[model samples]
Target: MTCAFILGAAVWPGGRPSPTLERRSLHAAQMYHAGRVSRIMCCGGLGRNAPSEADVMVEILTGAGVPRTAILIEDRSTTTRENIAFGLERLGMSDEIVLVTDGYHAPRARAIARSLGIRCTSDSPAHKARPRTILRESGAWLKFLWQRMRGI
Candidate 1:
């Protein structure tokens, strides 16, 4: 089975999904509708928002016509590494996975998955990265590299 792992993004103050989060969930829904993936796993925890990122993702996926039974929730991950690690542990060692997130975030997420011994592909929504987003992602890349170098 192929699973689309939808990584969490920011949730707005009113419990709404940020545009990036919505796009990621929608892309995963499309993958399911297109038969590219048989299931989806939403990965995230509560941030500054009331409902967790995974909860908002589930709302988006279901609203996009994907059934609840076709989705799995990993609602305790607050970072990319935890997202992949926790989700993979829940999924076991069988199904192939496709990481779904913003383009700027995909590389780090993929690398994290690889470091965990997971060979997976990735897909991202078409999003123009704002300068702030790019800068933030750069910092994230540095942190990821630092963690890898330290074997953390």
Candidate 2:
């Protein structure tokens, strides 16, 4: 089976998904409707909020018309590496994977997945990165490289 891993983003206060999170989830739903993937795995943990990112994704996805059975949740990861690691660990490496995220984030996500020995393709939502977002991603790249060097 093919599964699209929808990486989590911030969940606003009061259990709302951030715009980025909603976009990612909706993109995954589109993938499902287009027959690109048979399953959707929502990956994320609690982030300064009540409901976890995975739970919010479930709500959005189901609201988007995806069946409950076709969705999987991994709500233990708080970072990109953990999102890929814990999610794949729970889902197993058997199914083909399609990593879903914003374009600016896809490279790091794909790199992390490859380091874990999973070969996968990726599809990203149309996102216009603000200057702040670009700066944040640059920092993330530095952190990822540092962790890789230390074998963390």
Candidate 3:
């Protein structure tokens, strides 16, 4: 099964970028650079206050040597839920999907993909905020649980 799917990286405000974001970039770059994915499907949309995350990732990947056309952008996803729902259709049976994000997002991301019938593994970048990130990711998990509770 050559179905390899790696999630796109992240960007920050001012597009100043984050260490976590760079780790996301490195994960994608390594996958692409290693020839794990023939074409990459970058997923993410603009955050409420930030520019399009997919666009930022695309710029970095292309600059790092992934061909422009080889990178596909799923630029409509505003949340990790959308990342799965929209990303699955965009990818369409990625033999293997490595959900890339900071350490904490792993659980829900896999669950979301499975809900959409997209089986996946993960590729979490080493966290810059390992301790704080755990808390943040924990908070994210709570938010996800709350979203499910609210049925959003």
Candidate 4:
């Protein structure tokens, strides 16, 4: 069964889902309902706030009408690479999967998943990102490419 892995984003201090996270989790729910994936794995570790990003994602997915039984949480990862590594381990299967994140972030996430020998696809909610987010993701993508070039 294909699993959709929702990458982490910030959570409000009061455990509210950040806009990016909400979009990704909602997309995950839509994908699930459409039968694109059999399960959803929410991936992220705790931020400065109490609840982990995965926790916020789970709440959002369930609130969006995804069954709790179909959701899994990997709350031990803080970065995209860690998210893929730890999330794949938690899943315990190399079956087909999808990585859900912002458009700019998907390349790095996909590269990391591919490096781990995962058969994966990426999906974004197709929202325009803020200038700051684009800039940050650009730098991240460059780093990913450099690492790959260096065979790291």
In model 2, residue pairs whose N, Cα or C atoms come closer than 3 Å (at least 3 residues apart or on different chains), thus clashing, are: none
Lowest-scoring 10 consecutive residues by lDDT in candidate 2?
112-121
Give the CA lDDT, 0 to 100, for residue 33 in model 1. Answer: 99
Best by TM-score: 1
Candidate 1 weakest lDDT stretch, 10 residues: 85-94
Which is the winner by TM-score between candidate 1 and candidate 2?
1
Candidates 2 and 3: which is better by TM-score? Answer: 2
Per residue, candidate 1 scores C-alpha lDDT tens digits across 1-152 of 99999998999999999999999999999999999999999999989997999999999999999999999999999999999999998888799999999988999899999999999999998999999999999999999899999999
* Pick by TM-score: 1 or 3, better one: 1
RMSD in order of candidates: 0.7, 0.8, 2.7, 1.5
lDDT by residue (tens digit), candidate 2, 54-103: 99999999999999999999999999888988888889979999999999
lDDT tens per residue, model 4, 1-152: 89999999998888888889899999999999999999999999998886999999988888989999999999999889888888889888856789999888888788888877776899998788799998998898888889889988
Ranking by TM-score: 1, 2, 4, 3
Ranking by lDDT: 1, 2, 4, 3
Q: Which is the winner by TM-score between candidate 3 and candidate 4?
A: 4
Alpha-carbon lDDT of model 4: 0.90
Q: Where does candidate 4 clash, by residue pair?
A: none
Global lDDT of each model? 0.94, 0.93, 0.69, 0.90
Best by lDDT: 1
Against the hidden reference, what TM-scores do the models get?
0.98, 0.97, 0.80, 0.92
